[model samples]
Target: MKIGLIGSGDVGQALAHGFTSEGHDVKIGTRSPRENLVSYSDASSFGEIVVIATPWSGTKAAIDAAVAGNFKDKTVIDVTNPLVMRENGPPELALGHTDSGGEQVQRWLPGAHVIKAFNIVGNAFMYKPEFPHGPPTMFIAGNEGDAKVAVTRILTSFGWETIDIGGIEGARLLEPMCILWVLTGVRSGNWNQAFRMLRK
Candidate 1:
């Protein structure tokens, strides 16, 4: 699969490497595409799947600038959270409890199949994950069943145990998980911990 990544930051780089290592054609898109990196055009042309890994603030613009026309039949994985980061302290969710970044992305790209994944896991664990025990759960939610399945397979290839948390509305809850992830990182001074869904 040809994967188009919209950001070149930590999350983008991590997922790019993970996918490329799995033998998938990966293109990392940036506002300023360098020699090694590809432009948004390169991404759009090579896309089988497009992953929006940009910061919460630039999510809409990135999508608008990256893809042309309606991404109606394409699966666009939204890995962003509406976290408003302050210079003095940690990040907070900007959209509040009612709406989420994933939903907002879906709203902007109305025709695209938006799936929320990788928002709960830290960047450190995004690749071929090796926990103390077994594979950690990756929570995913989307309105499209087929899109979710494709995302699940990709995530599982990267060694994640996927959990389908219903439809896009589930993002209302999933986006807050970023706050929990960051809070745990700040409180314990460890950003390596990831949430795992266990059925008891």
Candidate 2:
């Protein structure tokens, strides 16, 4: 599998490394190309699966730059949080309750299977995370059944327990969960935590 990552930030790089370590060919897309990074269009065209890891502000532009057709019929993993940071305090969701980044990305690439994932945790744990209790749960939201399955497989490979929350609209819930993660980190001053779902 060739994984194209649309954003060379921490999240993208982390997932790219994980994919490569999992024996998949990985390409990172960026505005500034370098030895390891390729242009967004090139990366998108090169991948069997595309990951959208761009910051929320530039996600649309990155997708546009990658060419919408390049994502056609491909599984697109969205790891973005639509945040508006401030100097005074913790960041807040740019939009929520009715709209979300995942739905917007789906709208942007109607031909692509956009799945919202990896946004609820920090980049440090995006790949293989070790915990004393057990593998943490990763909640994914997407409309396509096959795409969600694919993402769940990847998450399992990266040492995660997954729960399919159903449809891209579930991002409305997942995105806010990101805020909770952040606020918990801010208040507790611990960045080394992840979420787990308990079953009785």
How do the residues 60-82 of candidate 1 rate in per-residue lDDT, one tens digit apiece? 78777776553557898899988
- Backbone collisions counted per model: 0, 0
- Candidate 2 has its poorest 10 consecutive residues by lDDT at 83-92
lDDT of each residue in 1-200, candidate 2, tens digit only? 99999999999989998999999999999999999999999999999999999888888899999999999999999999998888998888999999999999999999999999999999999889988999999999999999999999999999999999999999999999998998999999999999999989
Per-model TM-score, in order, reads 0.95, 0.99
Q: Model 1 — TM-score against the truth?
A: 0.95
Q: How many pairs of residues in model 1 come into backbone collision?
A: 0
Which RMSD does model 2 reach against the true structure? 0.6
- Find the candidate with the highest lDDT and give its number: 2
